[model samples]
Target: MANTTDDTTLALDAVKGEHPTDIFSLDGEGDWSPHITESNLPTKIIWSPTMGFSTVDKDVLAICEEAISELEKAGVEVVVNDSIWEVNPVESWMVFWACARARAQQHLIGTEEYESIDPLLRLFIEMGVTMDGASYASAIDACHHYNYQLEEAFQESPLIITPATCGQPPKLEGDGFVNGEETASWVDFTMGINMTRNPAGVIPVGNLDNNLPVAIQIIGQQRADLDVLKAMKAFEEVINFRERAEDF
Candidate 1:
């Protein structure tokens, strides 16, 4: 389910237990790859930066290869390449800022809204979530690009299978979450899907030794939410995925 072009696929390497599974690569299938690398990153990430993280984790790549071997045995076509897919994290940040602004404004003007909202609004204000006009325009362009590309891609391929996260879910350090690369790393796979406004859902595949579960994310095109859910059901049946987290 991982793209050879994306290093996040290496996250699968961290899985514990048996790694038996089918793997296959498709031909000319950058069909699922959405390019989002540091080089082409936005000049200003109103939320945070996407740097300092290694592009390719060798250990993770090795683990991904093993899983692919099993998938190939299952008659899946795995595409092998080193190209990057296009994605802009800023688009989602724009959406986040819009929501934050709406919530903050509601709290300021209305009564009996969510309690302690001022503190949350203050945090976002400090983070530059009230982006500039230029930034908002750029984000709008990015969203259009995403919708166009994703819609076109769906015409060729109805569904895309990918790792749900870069690796095992991390337990929070304390009461709050980390705000930089650490947080970005976890959503590396799902973020692009969010930007594209595609419907994506994850189905459990297996569990790590720490008892954290791993999943395979299934994504469908815009306005195809039902199709995506239907595909998830079919895939779960095909994999015989269970509610319980089983050994890898």
Candidate 2:
């Protein structure tokens, strides 16, 4: 995910010359690892000026930056923490669950008919444990661990901000939308926090030459949801996100 969009999806859009780089030869992960500086904060917050910001949800990033500064003034360190996603245990379980669901024509997040409660259809039903029976305790516990980290680290921050999508908006694909688009790509930026039950909201940013939305998702740490949201409200009243992102 060079930025955020899935490699397969990027390659699909690349065929039409809509992507910034040649996607066909992309290896997904040779380099491009996210890293932080001596301050232990990201040296480069991933942003693709070419892809630009979302014309529809641009206020988010500005509000987050503003909130960070305000929080700092009050003696707090506000940062967009780099997700230690590669080492996350829930991620592995999520993959297994996702694959199991896919085999039964079900999807974990994107599809309209997500069989979560009662789980009328799927392997879990055959084994009799859809939402929370017995076998899933391992996976659920792992998810809990993931959330605990968010609770401990992010709960103090006034607000957290992330791109709506890592790269740019995705384009239409061939015969079926499956390969070209997946819910994961669309949610690359903010879903991890969402998974931990953090409060999050997206605001219109700006757009690319292709007229795609490049919104920023604003997240709140745990129960501080209201303050985080209100902070964004304050920042939105003062900042000019579009003017600054003209070259985004």
lDDT values for all models = 0.47, 0.43
Give the poorly placed runs of model 2, Cα more than 4 Å off. Answer: 1-80, 83-135, 174-186, 241-248
TM-score of 1: 0.56
Q: Tens-digit lDDT track for model 2 on 142-245?
A: 66776676555444444555555544444464221112433333434443554566666554445555554445555666654444444444334333244333
**10 residues in a row with least lDDT, candidate 1:** 41-50
- What is the lDDT for 195 in model 1? 62
Tell me model 2's lDDT, rounded to 2 decimals: 0.43
Q: Measure candidate 1: CA RMSD.
A: 14.5
After TM-score superposition, the amount by which residue 211's alpha carbon in candidate 1 deviates from its true location, in angstroms, is 1.4
Per-model TM values vs. the true structure:
0.56, 0.45
